[model samples]
Target chain A: MRKKPIPGLSLLLAVLLVAEGCAPRIPGLERTSTTEAAAVRADDEDTWLKAHYRDGRVAIFDSWQVLQRTVEGDGVLLGADRDTLAVGPFVVPLDSFVLFETDRLTPGRSAPGLAVMTVVIGVVGFLCALNPKACFGSCPTFYAGGDGDEHLVAEGFSSSVTPTLEATDLDALWRVRPVDGVVVLQMKNEALETHAIRHADLLAVPRGPGERVLADGAGAFRAVSGLNPPAAGIAAEGDIAELLRAPDAKERTSLADSFDLATREVIDLRFDAPATGDLGLVVRSRQSLMSTYLFYHALSLLGAEAGSCLALLERGGMGGAQSLLQPSEALGFIEVQLPDGAGGWRTVGEVGETGPLALNVHLLPLPAGCDASRVRLRLTKGHWRLDWVALATLGEAREAVRLPPSAALRDGFDDPETLDTLRDPDHVLAALPGDAVSLVYELPPGDGDWELFLEARGWYLEWMRQEWLGSPDLAAASRLLGDPAGSLRRLAPAYKSVESGMEEIFWGSRYVRAAR
Target chain B: MSARRASIAAAAAALVLGGCAGAPGPRGYLSTAPEVVHTARGGWVKVVRSSADATFGSQLVVEGELLAAGADTLHVLTGTGPLTVVRAPRDRVTLVGLHNRAGERALASLGLSILSLSNGWYSVITMPLNWLVGIVESHTQSRVGVLEIRDGPWDACRTHARFPQGMPPGLDPQRLTLHWYWPSAPRGFSTPR
Candidate 1:
């Protein structure tokens, strides 16, 4: 948890690389001459011999033997008058040759790149200074080999920042079409944080034709058939026609009010109540990273005590709810409200979970005998990106078959016991920045439709940046971690200072983009 | 692992992989004068000639279009001496090599390598590695014939000669460009075991 602060180490290294690349490429300047005895002693089949004559003639031999007075070898006589003339089996007197030499390594291609870089670098100069303050964001990034090249499938437990806040996160491995009986999930820690993954289990349920298995707010899987879009959906801006019509990334969001991030906004949708089975309000949405920024800023406020402060949360140092997770909790869920059919709107249930990187789909099951014709969704302004909102007809709850990872590998080295560790709640597969583990899961071979949900239980620790140091706010830290609504109101302007750049900075973590 | 250890490993990987980028791949060569007949894929030849001094600075070089090579003899044509023939003898010949150019690529690589310095501490390792890759890629590659550099009664060299069938029936050496088999030139690349 404790890291030493290094100053100017980054700048020094950048300058050093520029210098190495900037060095002059003088032709044959790298060639170092050796004595005849040194060349003979080090000579072998792999050795190449160079004969320098007093008459200014030079030749290279592929193989040679030194006689009492004559050097007899087979190789080429480099003649300027023609192609390097090949010669051999003939004896050249030691007296005729001024020096005999050999080189172990070829001066690989003299990089023309160095010369070009030197000029370009000389002109551009140092553009980025070595800033030790790094942008912070991390989670176990999972790639199902489906999310385009750059897009990640899911980031595990994006909200779980500490041991106390560690919770089992469920993510639908969206867009994955499993081939054969295998599903390989590449779990990567692409940030400056340590991930302690307790377990990664593939929870799957049979999905019949035209039927989708979705989890409710309480993590209960429901078979929802005929998910119909709202007859009409309207938000603060206008009709939510193109945006919230489907689970596309095309989302509907309102800007944060100038004064408060907690300002509330609602979208009303009219749906034709399915007179048959139980109904559920299906909402697929994700947080806006505003909460993530607040969390990091709060940690920065803690400064030197960041580690100790987190340890306190883990050890119950700051009592009550988790201070780090409080802002997210204050923003609350996407609360669904349906008309009582008596002029007032009554609460139905809530949908959505935390995580700004991936979309969360939840079935907020409507209470029996309730009118599902009209619904209103209430949420904090700019706090969420709603991708889809629909009314689904729910069926019976189905039991799931858990498929645990059969093997875990990193760089081709197998660690099969990682399977057992993933099962045990007490153990964790720890991953540092740049570390990656492939979790291989084998399912029963079948053509039947099955939806896979990743149940990743873990937590992570963000490595503090130097920019976070020197500022310590104890009372404010407590208020932020425990009471977000109150502190959010006071910290509004401060949050605004970084609101515009936070998302870009958080996503563009230096460690995350490291060469894979 | 500590961030320091992870960073160290990353740097090490960068160096090893970077060195590999410019590593002599299958010794590919591009001929600038493709129209001319050449024994090797590339006909350009550089002969490093060293005096008794043997110092790098004391060395001079003769570079020209390769003509032909026979057993213990090399013939080259030079444009600098007003389209003359050069007959370089084995005794005066030093190191001989055929070369290629990767100047443009090397320069571009250097530019990008310098730009990567913005990556903070990572630049220290990446910068030099980038430059190395560029240079390695821009190598003066060795060809098959050059790789097997030994006494040549080479069929290709003989065929590429102005007098492939050993001097013509009525052609005179003085009338045609004088065949300079052994000229005042240079040496070979040396290696330790």
Candidate 2:
């Protein structure tokens, strides 16, 4: 349909360009009287100006006419002998000076114009040709509107695949920074799934400067300090101490065992044991696309009957089917252990966080009496990607205040139902496909800094895929549900064939990056 | 490079863009397929084959029967003489589309839509508006589909390759075909039982 372009769109674009092109200018570059300019002599010291003289010679001055009636500047001759007449510092009487000026530059208006135009055009193009808002999402994908754009901080209850399986998932809103004591956390159901959200709130804890509120594996939040990076980290691939030394995105991920998706890989870490108080092993990591593969493949196996199957699970008709953890049961958590002096190892605790959109920070605080000389992490070979690992001096354990949405907006209009559903335990905010609800919360006033953890409680049912209907592998689904380990091994060859493209099809959806 | 060059480039761009999208061709007619099947070769890629720099390596929606997709390169069978295989950089190939019946029904649907004026002058807006809406909605839905891998590790699309395991492998791609190197693959999804 070749409809004529709307004049309103052009006007909107023009306004955007104008807004972008308008940048704040440096003060005092205005037109001023000679007396006023003379008064600001100190300011002129930084301003470079070209002085034209009555004589054929030219001079550039930093301190224009500093002395009574003359100025000292680099003497430049513009005649044929200009190159030969060495340029040097010389003084010229103000009487001989013809002009006093500084080169003026108009900021590149086109650059801003092009940028605004590109953004405007890109947005229009996306709206017309792409559905960025309908991309990959599971559970309640939270967006704390920070840094001008919506920054994805946490995804709540990502592991909960159905209503009966719903669990409370905690995620540190590390990237979120409250503005004027307010944080607007946007909850969006961007995937083709029905998300039943019961509680959407923030856990706020006070912390001092240079201190972070980290979650311990035992579900305790603590303001930890003295972050000590591991001295050495030895993985199956090789040494990865350098990668684990910082919370940089440069991660260490290993290849999956072609046969068993649950194959464990160990990374032995050596940390300089702190002399005094208790410590916690902090691990920064995110899940690999393996879970996404299992989930999607399970859906495919369920095939055309997936919708009905999921509906059945929702109604509690499928017995304990809603408790389906599948491949994750074999590979979900990361085990942390300490080397027993007698060459044996003692299990300390396990750190588990789901979703691949953002990296999670998990602190496995060792028991007070346990030794922390050496630590070994046992996790599924390719299931987890580590960004950083450190031992922190555990400070005071703090409780977070849950702040629910002060106001809620679904898409754009005020949604009282979402607010009610989130607050009332009996009712659930069942978000359907393409639903974007912004939850605005005002951080409680008080303190130097606050650490926020997103407390999202919900479960979602993935919509049936039309493509999967072509070949319904119900037997595969049953095996996946019944015997995960064997099924994962048998399905390895097929999964490997299409593994590389799975992330693109799963998490790389425009919906994940959709504007709030 | 220069003012004159920029203006000429802009003019050429407008001229080329002007030729794309109209009442009947590849625009406002098609809706999302009720069902779509992956044809191997990088999920049925539909690249805009172009030679101009202004296009940034995109132009017309060329023949979308992707032959073989690797990590770096994409081989698409252009429907030219002898069905020449047009090789493009995987990164440069932006569009990926499924070969739905949109091509077959597009002309007929469009022709009938033109006569949809029997509904009165209101047909002017409704006919094209509905068609364009369908196009937009379809593309958006396709974005999250399994085969819509515009941002790719391209290796998986190779599953759809004529030689799924690439041209060389010990019977790669899990598909059995022979050609000295390997046997020819069967036309449709023939997953080894």
Candidate 3:
């Protein structure tokens, strides 16, 4: 088929459409799209926008058409009829513009009403950009209304872990060590008391802050962190008997001035009024009991009624001494006795208390090489107070470390053996051999007469008590008679008694034995 | 008034117009093939002999024999020298040809192709916008007789029909299979079985 072209009418219509600004109909939508139309409008607005965007710079605007805004370096550019606006980096919509301005197309003269609206919009835009609520039409994301910029801030010293000092027993020696930042005091029990140095409550010297003081009343003390010696001195001021002596030189030095002479190892001496005029004590010899030697002496208290008392004193030794006893040694043996020829003896007067009697004893000097730093005294008779005023010098061979006599006399009335023996009618002290002492007393044939005899070696001390002196044969018979009960009753008028003397020695050693 | 004068005038006008209207001959149009090529090293197809009667607008339907042992590949004879390979979708074989846009549209709109049926093979109706006559020469057995792209209800001018119903011989509809290939693939397209 041949088609004829009728171009005149179509060409005329196309020209009319182009001139009228009616675009060609696109395939889909007949009307012009707003996107395409926006491009057309941009042509005129681009000059205003170009100054802001030529190098990809940006000017923030409050409204679609106003130019008022804070300008930044790069942003998206939007154009409307007669104006162009630059929106900053955000993606806010055109309707939400808060602060904007009108950039006048004519440089000098701004559009009067539009320019005012632009400035108004510009203020709003800047506020809205800075403050989201103005632009976003909602409260700022979280908390917004604070003045400028401020916030809340958190607010307490940790407690200390100090340790308390406890009182300790001070009877023994102690040593101190600081190990691993802790101070430890060790005792003989071989246990260590560790104190954390940092955690302990620090005790400082009065003036020195570095020095630490710890007083555990147990005689333990320490100084930490500095060189400060502990205060050392004896706390008590009285004399104490050292029974178990320390071998240490330091302990000896401590005891030297602290103990009295009687408390050191030495023999004791005492003196009393002699019972007869011109009486004297004699030392016959010195002998050894073990390794130690002692001086011996025979002592006599003289009086017309003293023979009976002196015999009792010999009986107090359980037997008289073998040799003359030293007066210093004989001081402890004070008793009176009456003897029977049958080798029995009886105590008559107050032998330990105030008897005129005498006996023998030996004085033992402190042994050679013996550490006589401690001494303990014990008495078997009366309140034996001995006062020593003599100061002696030590010898190369042997030295008598003399001590004041501690006088004690015990009355042995409570002793059942002695008491029963005294009460028995048939009991008799049998005759001893020629060499042994006869500890015996015989009663007289008649009443009220008694005698006691004490024999040892070749020495004899005999006491005869006679109330039958007017009858010659009766008096001679009384010389060989002894009844312990009758003799005690017969001599009860005497001031010193044997029973009281033994009680003193028995009670005096109670403390000494316990401590030993 | 004279025959010689009229011929001479006509000759002169032709000469003048030839110089003015001699637009440059259309440069040979090079295009990416619609069906991507997948070729083994030696596989090729060429126009061994072309009809002198064929003109520029003449339609061509060339289906090279593909005896693929393991996989199928295509070779398009470029007419320059060698054959160019193309890829085809799995389960569907491709035929490369040339046709006008109106012809392709007519086939797409009407669901028929005289050329495809002339050889007794089914030819696919491609997009009307495509100028190439390349067709998917396979029919999906599952979705048969259904018009995939149809004209609006009752508009005969916008013909509506199923793709690839009628075809020429040697390409059976049962033997041929339509397989969807991802469009962007440069090689034979295949979907997981």
CA shift of A359, model 2, Å:
1.7
The i-RMS of every model, in angstroms, reads: 13.6, 30.0, 44.2
**Local accuracy of candidate 3 as per-residue lDDT tens digits, A1-516:** 998977867875655444334321111101111112123122233122212221112232222332223222333453211123534544333333222222212121111222222232333334323222111211000110112221100000000001111111111011111223222110000001111111101111121243322222122233223211112111133232131111111111111111111122222222222122111111111111100001100111122333343344345432332212222233332222223235543332211111111111112222233222222232222223221111111212211111111121112123344324323433422211111110112222233211111111111122222321222332322321222223222322331333232222222322111211
Give lDDT for model 1: 0.60
Per-residue alpha-carbon lDDT of candidate 1 for residues A317-412, written as tens digits (9 for 90 to 100): 677226577777787878899887788887777877776656677788888867777889989887887888888888889777899888888666
lDDT tens per residue, model 2, A1-516: 899999878987787657466622211121111222234233243354444333323354444445677666553433211122445676766666544434222221122322333343333333322222123445677776643355667777877887678889888877788888888887777566788988988888888889998987667889899998988999977789999998866678776788877788889998886546788889888787777667777887888877777777677664565536766676668899888778878778888687766678898888786667688998987788788898888899898888988889854688887788788988888888657778888898775588988887878776665666766776767778778888778877776665554433323333233321
RMSD of each: 15.9, 31.7, 57.0
Most accurate candidate by lDDT? 1
**DockQ of model 2 vs. true complex:** 0.01
The alpha-carbon deviation from the true structure for residue B141 of candidate 3, after best TM-score superposition, in angstroms, is: 99
lDDT by candidate, in order shown? 0.60, 0.58, 0.21
TM-score of 2: 0.54
Per-residue CA lDDT of model 1 for B1-193, tens digit only, reads 2244445544654454444433221122222211111222113343444344446433334444344455544444443331222333322332223222234444456456546544443444445556565545444322211322222333334422332223323323233222222342223211111
**Alpha-carbon runs more than 4 Å astray in model 1:** A1-137, A146-151, A272-276, A445-447, A503-516, B1-193
Per-residue lDDT of A21 in model 1: 59
Q: Give chain B TM-scores in order.
A: 0.44, 0.38, 0.16
